[model samples]
Structure formats: structure tokens, C-alpha cells
Target: MTTPRIVSLVPSLTEAVAHSLPGALVGATDWCTHPASLDVERIGGTKNPKVERIVALAPDLVVANEEENREPDLDALRAAGLDVLVTEVRTLPQAVAELDRVLTACGLTTRPRWLDEAEAAWDAVPAPERRRTAVVPIWRRPWMVLGRDTFAGDLLSRLGYDHVHAGHPERYPRVPLDELRAAAPDVVVLPDEPYRFSAEDGPDAFPGLPCAPVSGRHLTWYGPSLAEAPAVLTTALRAALD
Candidate 1:
């Protein structure tokens, strides 16, 4: 069987497909930065990919995420008669399952080893003795946080960090800085993407609370990064408390 040529709009999905099938990827978004040596036709960013360029590539399959991609762009691709595989992963289980489905669609006959390792890594995480309440800020200025049903929120919950805005109606809600502080969470969890929250920048905002500056990829991206996220995030979270 001929290997399917793939174009991945999501960075995590790009990494997953790249690892599973080395030569399978023919096009990927500029944001798909994993596998550092990955050389493929660079489409635009996730939110605004050049639809025409993707169609011109004539890939066998195009992988995208519901959250990372725009519906209109996907519609355009489908209109061009391309096979598109859209994945929605809001939890670890969903991620695990979606990875399998994606690789299979890319023409893999068996589950990749990295996927197995990622599942085992999450499974090995022991239940926390006590849960810590946190406010996870994705961006500042307007102050958007991880609210109800977010992948990051679900991942943090597994790590024993209960999101304060988990009950909010919006997935990513804009809250005033005053309200955020008033929530009085045990800690302020900060990931360094979609915003780049650093030790010097993010921690100063919440004067009295511990600020855990963690890797954005580990906190959010659902790919090979999941295997080390538990240990990496735990160390960052614990360092803030210590």
C-alpha cells in the first residue's frame, strides 16, 4: 500500500504523525515545530492557513484539531475534494484515542510505541493526597483563563490541580485581573505559550500566590510531550511551593 501524504495543521498532531510515519508528512503549518529536523511545505499558522497552498500539495490526508483550526478553512479544503481528519481531544483519554485514530488514518497498521509510552506515563501518575486549587492564565492584558472542558484543564485535574474556573460557562473566559486575584486560588499556574508567561513576567501579577511557570507544550500539547509532562509539570509546580 502506498503511504498517505499528510498535512497537519496542529503542531501536536504534526509531531505525532511525523514520528509514526517518517516520510508520510508532505505539508505542515508553521507552528508545527516538533521533530526539530522536520522539513515540509510550511503552510500558514494554525488559525490562518493558506488553503490554496494546502490544496495544491494534494496530500492524501490533512489532520486538524477542532480547537486549533477554523471551520471555514476546513470547509474550503473539503470543497476542494480533500480528505480531512478533524480531531477533538479534551482529555488524556481522548488524546490517547485520537492519536491512534490519526496514525491509523495516516496508514499505520499498528499503534506507535510513543503512544503506548505516553499512555503508560499518565497511568503511572499516582493519585494526589490533596488537590490544589489553581487559576491557569493562558494570556494576560485581557486575562483569559482555562475554563470548563479545556484540554489543559483536564490535564491539570489529572495532576491534582483543580481549576477555579472549571465551572465557568466559557471554555476560555476573559476575567478582570481584580476578579482573578479575588478568587484567591492556592496558586497561579502559568504556561508559556499562547502568551509566554515567564518567571519575571507572570509571577509579579499575583503578589501573594505561588506562580508555577511551566512548559506550555507539556501543559497543553497532546503528543509525544505527554510522556514527560507529569514529571516536568510536577517539578515546576512543586518548585513554586518550595
Candidate 2:
């Protein structure tokens, strides 16, 4: 079978597909910003993709993630007779496996070299000895935190930061600022996406606590970025701890 033309709604997946097959991606959501110069038709945001524009592009497949995209949008694309490939990756292993699945399903007979490098990168990681307790907030106003079964939480755990709310029932639950600060975690891990938490904005929330500002992509994204996540995230975590 010929390689399917894809429209990606997930930014990480967009980069993966674009990096692997280059021109295979013909359309992507506005949020798919990797490859810096990716030349694809814009189909709006992940949650609010332009179904008509996607259909107009006549792509063979539209890619999305279960957590980052809405079911109604996937249903809409499927209803339009466009094949939609949805992936569910909440862990590093799942990320690697799903990338292989998506690539193979898209017609690549072999896995990409970056996939190997990404796997090797994580495989080389040894468990950090000085594990610290941390509160990782993804959003501020109303304050949602990384809870159970999250990619970011797993990454933190591997990097030796125990998430204070890892047992919360919701994957991301809103905790009042007072409650979060009162938790008295060793550090506050702030990612620069979802809410773009920065040194000035997020660290101020917890005056005395160390705030480790890191890239949201390295923490959450599971594509090409995964190759460098271990080193990049470790540096930030260590810097904050120091």
C-alpha cells in the first residue's frame, strides 16, 4: 500500500510523522509547531480543528491523541470518511510503542532511527539517588496539577521527583493555591506549556520552594523530543534542587 497522507492534530505526533516521512503530512493543527519550518495546511487547534478544511485537504488519515484531542472531533473526521488514527500514550514505553504503531500503520516498514535513539536515551537513564518530593502544576488560575497516570508524572518519577499528588483519582485535578503551597513539597516543577509558566509567574506562587522551570514538550511530548528529554529534564530538576 502507498503511504497515507496524514493530518496531525497532536504536536508531538506531527513532528514524528513529519520527521519520518517529511511530505507525508499535508495538514496539521495550529498547535503542531515542531520542525519549525513544517509547511502544512493549518487545521486550527487540537480541540477545535476545522473538519471541513481537513476534508478539503483530502488526507488519507488524521492523527490525534486520546488525551490531547476530543472524541467528537475524531468522530467528525471519521464521519467525513477520513480515517482517524488515535493514540493513547501515558508512559515512556507506551510512547515508543505507539510511535512504532503509528509509523507502521502509516506504511513505514521499519522504525525510524530517532525512535531507536529515543529508546536508547531513556534506557541509559539510571535511577536518581536523591529523590525529592515535588508539586507539579500544569495550569495556574484555578491551579490544576499533574495527578495519577500522567506522562509528566512518570517522567518526574524516573528523574527522582516524587509527585505529591500522584495518587489523585483525576489525571489532572485543580487544587487551591493555599492547599498546594501548604503541601510543602521540596520543589515546584513548572512546565512552559499548557500555561507557559515562567520564572517570574510560576515561581512566585511558592516563595520559599524551589521552582524547576522546564519545557512542557520534554515532560509531556513523546516523539522526537523524547530522545533529549532525560538530559534536558534532569538538568532543570538538578538546577532547581541546587
Candidate 3:
């Protein structure tokens, strides 16, 4: 019997599910840092996963994300006669749906109970005192934050966070440092990738701010693994607040 060969086009899925699926994941991006078992390939990324390289892998399935992978790339893969599975996870519930979707695609009929346990984890966080949080997705020459209409912002709302910066719109909106300081959020977090903000890289953008570093996907993926975020981010938040 031939083992199922797989290729992961997004780091988040690679870390969260691909390795756990008991299939041969021959390739993944540089960012697929978990399991540390299939750390063999550094294929492109969500928007730019190397098609030719993935083709070379001759995977039975390719896992990606609608938001993470570019449409043209997905189009070309389909045109080349590949059955690409794209997951679009917005809120936490969608995340659970995606796990089921991916499991079915892999020709696997079983799912672990941990999936439900994961979903319930986020429910445990005491509702935000007020939905007043400022989310900065990237911070560089020009600081950028998520605005009101984006999926990231919407998740903040569901979790009872106000996402103070969503009023800016434009998904990843660039703002002045002074404006971030003015936002005066109860918590300010930096994602680990796209911008790689650390407690070291800092909340200098918001002085005297309760800032902390967190895994971007842990807080943002909104998938079957959301139950893990609050505990992880809260542990980080505890350190920052303490």
C-alpha cells in the first residue's frame, strides 16, 4: 500500500494539521516550524507557494488557505489538473469546519476529540472587559493594523474585543505611531510573522502600553485550533502584565 503523499502551501496548516494527519507531507514552507519532522522543504509561501516544486513532489493532495494563497496560483494548480484543498477560516467555528473538511479530503473518516476541546478553549476566556483592543498586524517603516471589515477584526469582536483600530479600515492599514499611542488599548499584541514582532521588538509604538508578543496563528487562524490561543496568548499576556 502506498502512503499518501502531501504538500502544504501554508505554514499555519502545516504546523497545525498536516504533520498530525499521519500522511507523508513531503514539502512545506520555511515557517512550518512545528513537529520538526517534515522540515525538509522550504517551498514558497501562501501567496507564492512554488507550483513547479509542488508539482515535482507529485503530492496526492495540496493543502492551502483561500486567504493565505493567491487566487492566480490556485487557478494555475487547478488548470494543471491538481485537486487543491483550500480552507477559508474566518471565525472560530469556521476553523472547526475546516478541520472536518480537510480530514474528509485526505480520505480519512476519523477525527480526534481534541478538535472539540480546542474549540471550547476560546470560550473560556472571560469576555473582554470592553471590546477595546488595538491590533497591529505589522510594524515597520509605516505601522499597519487591521480595520473594521477584515476577518481578523471580526474575530476580535466575537471574542468580545472592540478592535479599536478596525475603525481605520483597509485591512492592513498604515498609521502614525502617535495614533497608535492615542488608541490606548487594554492589550496590544504583535504577530510572530509577516512582521516578526517580539516583546523585544516592542510596543515602542505605544509607550506605557500592556504589550506582548504572540503566535500570529495562535490568535488569528480562527480554525480547529483556536482553543489553544487564549491559553498561549494569555500566558504571554501574563508575563507582560506581571
Candidate 4:
């Protein structure tokens, strides 16, 4: 049986598929930057993928995430008669299961070592003695934060942090900075993507709170990065508090 040619619109999925089924990826979005040595056709950004170009690539399948991609773009891909596999991952367990499903769809019969390692890494994490309240801001200009049912919120919960806005209806809600400051979170968790919240940039926003500036990829992405996220994130969060 011939291996299916794939195009990944999700960055994390691109890395997962690339690591699991080398050379199977024919195209990927510009933001798919893991495995820095990856050589494939650059499609476009996640939200604005070039449908016509993807169809031109004639991939056997195109993988996308419900959160990272827009509905109309997916509909357009389907309209073009292309087989598109859409994945929705909102938690750690879902991420693992989806990775397996995606790898299987890509014709991988055996589970990749990275996937097993990632699962084991998360499983080995001991539950925190006490949970801290946090507010995770994804963007700055309008000040949007992780709200209800977010993958990042789930990861933070596992690491013993509860998002202040977890009960909010919107997945990403724009809250006024004054209101965020008023929440009086024990710590302000900032990931460096969607917005590049560095030491010099993000900490000043929260006057007295400890700011844990972590890798956005580790906090948000669900791929090989998961294997090391616990240790990396723990270290960053602890450093900020200590």
C-alpha cells in the first residue's frame, strides 16, 4: 500500500506527523516550525491557508485543528474534493488520542515512540499539593485570555494552576486590564506566543504578582514538545515564584 501524502495546517500536528511518518508530509503551513530541518512545501498561515495551492499539491489528506483553522477554509477544502481530517483537542488525554488517530490516518501502523513518551511524561507528573489561581493572557493589545474549555487551561490545571476565567463562556475573552488586575491571581502565567510576553514586556503589566513567562509551544502545543513540557514549565513557574 502506498503511503498517503499529507498536508498539515496545524503546527503541532505537522510536527507529530513529520516525526511519526517521515517524508509523508508534502506540504505544511508556514507556522509549522518544529523539526527545524523539515523540508516541505510552505502552504500559508493556519487561519489563511491557500486552498487552491493545497489542492494543487494533490495531497492524499490534509490535517487541521478546529481551533487553529477557520470553518470556511475547511469547507472550501472539502468543496474542492480533498479529503480533510479535522481534529479537535481540548485536553491532554484528547491530545494523545487525537495524535494516535492522526498518525493512523497517515498510515502509521505502530505508535511513535514520541507519542508514548509524551503520554508517559504527563502521567508521571505528581498532582500538586495545592492549586494556585492564575490568569493566562494569550494576546496583549486587546488583552485576551484563556477562558473556558481551553487546552492550555487544562494543562495548567494539571500543573496545579486554575485559570481565573475558566467559567467564562468564551474560549478566548478580551478582559480589561483593570479587571484582570482586580482578579488578584496568585500568579500571572504568560506564554510567549499569540503574544511574545518576555521578561521585559509582560511582567510590568502585573504590578505585584509573580509572572511566569513560559514557552508558548510547551504550554499550548500538543506534540513531541509534551514530553519535556512538564519539567520545562515547572522550572519556569517555580523560578518565578521563588
Candidate 5:
């Protein structure tokens, strides 16, 4: 079985999938910084993939996602007759599908037993009993939040938590703190990235509501890593609900 010489064109799954596929990855975008120890070659970012630089790496397959990456690069890569595996993940199921596709494209089907363990963990994660959650994704000017139709919201819905702004049609909506108060989230989860929600940030408008820091990667990036996120998220959700 020959492993394909792979290059990851997206940053979100770069570091993680690189480690999972073993020798399949030959290059990745400059932002692929997860397995921090591996010295994979750099291609570029979502907008600027440095096509010339990527071509130089001579990858047998290039993996990319639809979120942050642009379409033109995909077109150019396809036009050049490169073997590209593009995955568009919008939901948790889609995230799992993306990982499965990557592994299939890399020509490795027999995944480690840990993958089953991870899937079991997700399956075992008790569904949220009563919908209740105040998921605050960011801490910044205008105060952004995950709303209906966003990946975070989809996950929140799965956990049985009533996402504070899931009613809004927009994805990440910038609203006044007052608006959040009106929504009144029972559990306010501040994620660790993009906005870096912190306990030191102090009590928000809510007095008795449970406020805690959460993992941005688990909530945001749905992939191989997410297989383990159920335990973490379940623990957090239980803590918040309890």
C-alpha cells in the first residue's frame, strides 16, 4: 500500500490530519502549527496559498476545506491536474465525513482503534436534558456570538442546549450586551480562541448564570480531534447545568 504524498491546504485540519495520516503529508499551509514538532513544508494561507510554492512541493494530493480557504485556488489546483480533496464541513456529521474523506484519499482505511473509542465517547455523551446554554464565542468590540446556522450553534443544539442567539438567522452576530441579556443564556460558555474568553474577564450582565471558559477548537473545528471533544464538552455542559 503506497501512501500518497499529501499537502494540507487548510489551516484548521492541517496540524491534526498531518499527524493522523503519518507519511502522507509532505507540505501544508504556513499556519499548520499543531503537531508543533513536525517540520512540514509550508504552502500558504486560505487566501494566499502561494500556488507557485505549493507546486514546488510536488504533492500527490492536496487537502483543503471550504471555510476559510478561497475557491480560486481550488480551481487553479484542479486546472493544473493536481489531485485535490476538498471537504466542505457545515455540521458535526460533516466534520466526521471530512476526516473520513481525508483518510480515504490518503489511501489508509484501517484507522486506529482510538477512532472507535472516540466515536463511542461521542455516542455516549448524554444528550442535554433541558435545552439551556449561553454560548459566547468571542470577547471583543461589538461582542460577537454564534447564532443559528453556524457550526457552533449546530453543536449546541446537539448538546441539548438552547443557544442564546440560535434564533437569529445570521451566523456570527455582533450585538449589544443588552441584547444578550434579553436572550438570557442559562450557561455562558466563553471559548478559548478567536476571542479568548477568560474568567478574569469578570461577571457579565448575568448574576447567577454559570460562566466558564471553554475550548474553541472542540467547538469550532469538527474533525479527528472532535472525536474526543464529546467528553470534554459533556463535562463542561454538566458542570454548567449542575
Candidate 6:
């Protein structure tokens, strides 16, 4: 079968599809910013994609993430006779596996070289010698944290940082700043994403704690970015120690 024209709704998946299949992607959400030179039609945001515009594009398939997109939009696309491939990747291993599934489903008869390289990079990293307690705040104001059963939490756990909110009832729970600081974590890891936390902005929240400002893509994205995440995150985490 001929490879289908694609529209990617998730940012990470957008980069994955664009890099792997090139011009296969005809449309993507405004948030799909990787490959910075990407020139696809902007369908809108992940949470709020322009379904009518997407249908108007007449794409053969739409790629979306279960967590990043709502079902109603996907339902609407399906109702319009468009094929939608939804992925769920909540762990490191799942990310690798799901990407494989997505590519194959997208009509690649063979796995891409970058996928193998990404898998190899994760395999080369040894288990942490010592685990440190950390509180990873994804957003402020309401102060949402990485709580139970999340991809970022799992990624950090594998990298030797135990999230203080791992047992919280909510996947991304909102905790008070004073309570988070009182947790007395060994470090506070800030990712430059969803909230755009930076060295100047994030560290100030936890005055006495060590703060490691890292790239959100390295910590969260599961595409070609995974190939370099281990090294990138370790370097950022190490900087917090000094």
C-alpha cells in the first residue's frame, strides 16, 4: 500500500513522523515545532486542533497521542472518514515500542536507523548507583507535579531521581509551594516546557534546594530526541550538584 498522507497532532510524534517519512506529513499542530524548518499546514494546538481544517486537508491519516489529545476530536475525524493512529507511551520502554508500532502502521517495512540508535543509547546507560529524592514541578501558580504513572516520572526514576509525588493520587497533582519546599528534596528538576521553566525563573521558587533546569523534550519527548536524552539529562542533573 502507498504510504498515507499524515497529519500529526502531538509535537513529539510530529517530529517523529516528519523526520522518518519526510513529506509524508502534510499538516501538524502549531505546537509541532521540532525540525524548526518544518513547513506543514498548522491545524492548531494539540488540545484544540481545527478538525474542519484537518478534514479539508484530506489527509489519509492523523497521528495523535492519547494523553495530549481529546477523544471527541479524534471521533470527529473518524466520523469524517479519516484514519487516526493514536499512541500511548507512558514509560521509556513503551516509547520505543510504540514508536516502532507507529512507524510500521504508517507503512515503513523496516525500522529507521534513528530508532535503533535511540534504543542503543538507552541500553548503554547503567542503572543509577544512588537514587536521589526530587520534586519535579511541571507548572507553577497551581504548582502541578509529576505524580503516579507518568512518562516523565518514569524517565526520571530510571535516571536516579525518585519523585516525591510518585504516590500522589493525581497523575499531575497540584501541591502547595511551601509543602514542596518542605519535602526537603535533594534536588528540584525543572523542564523548559509546558511551563517554560528556566534557570532565572524556576530556581527562585526553591531557594535552598539544588535546581536542575533541563530541556523538556529530553525529559518528555520520545522520538529522535530519545537518542540523546540520557547524556543530556545526566549533564543537567550533575550541574545541580555543583
RMSD of 2: 1.1
C-alpha TM-score for every candidate:
0.98, 0.97, 0.85, 0.98, 0.85, 0.97
Expressed as tens digits, the lDDT of each residue in 129-201 for candidate 5 is: 5667665656567688887667676776777776777777777788887677666677777787767777755
Instruction: For model 4, give the 10-residue run with minimal summed lDDT.
Output: 200-209
lDDT of 4 by residue, 1-242 (tens): 78789999999999999999989999999999998999999999999999999999999999999999999999999999999999999999999999999999999999999888998999999989899999899999899999999999999999999999999999999999999999999889999997998886555799888889999999999999999999999999898889
lDDT of 2 by residue, 1-242 (tens): 56678889999999999899877999998988898999989999988999999999999878889999999988988999998889998888888889998988777888899999999998899977778899999998879999999988988888888999999999999999999999999989999999999898655789888888999999999899999999999999889888
Name the 10 consecutive residues with the lowest summed lDDT in model 6.
200-209
Return the clash pairs for model 4, or none: none
The digit string of per-residue lDDT tens for model 1 on 111-229 reads 88888899899999999989999999999888999999988999899989999999999999999998999999988999999898889765578888888999999999998999999
Which residue runs does candidate 4 get wrong by more than 4 Å?
Answer: none
Each model's lDDT comes to: 0.92, 0.90, 0.69, 0.93, 0.72, 0.90
The model with the greatest lDDT is: 4
Question: By the lDDT metric, which is better: model 1 or model 5?
Answer: 1
Of 1 and 2, the candidate ahead on lDDT is 1
Local lDDT at 106 for model 2:
72
Task: State the displacement of the C-alpha of residue 43, model 1, in Å, after optimal TM-score superposition.
Answer: 0.6
lDDT tens readout by residue for model 3, 1-242 = 56677777776667555534655678887667666666556777667778888787877888888777888998887777778999886566677788778766766557756676776675676866645465455656777777655555565565555667676646677877777778777777677767788666664566688777877777666444566766776677556657
Query: Model 1's lDDT to the true fold?
Result: 0.92
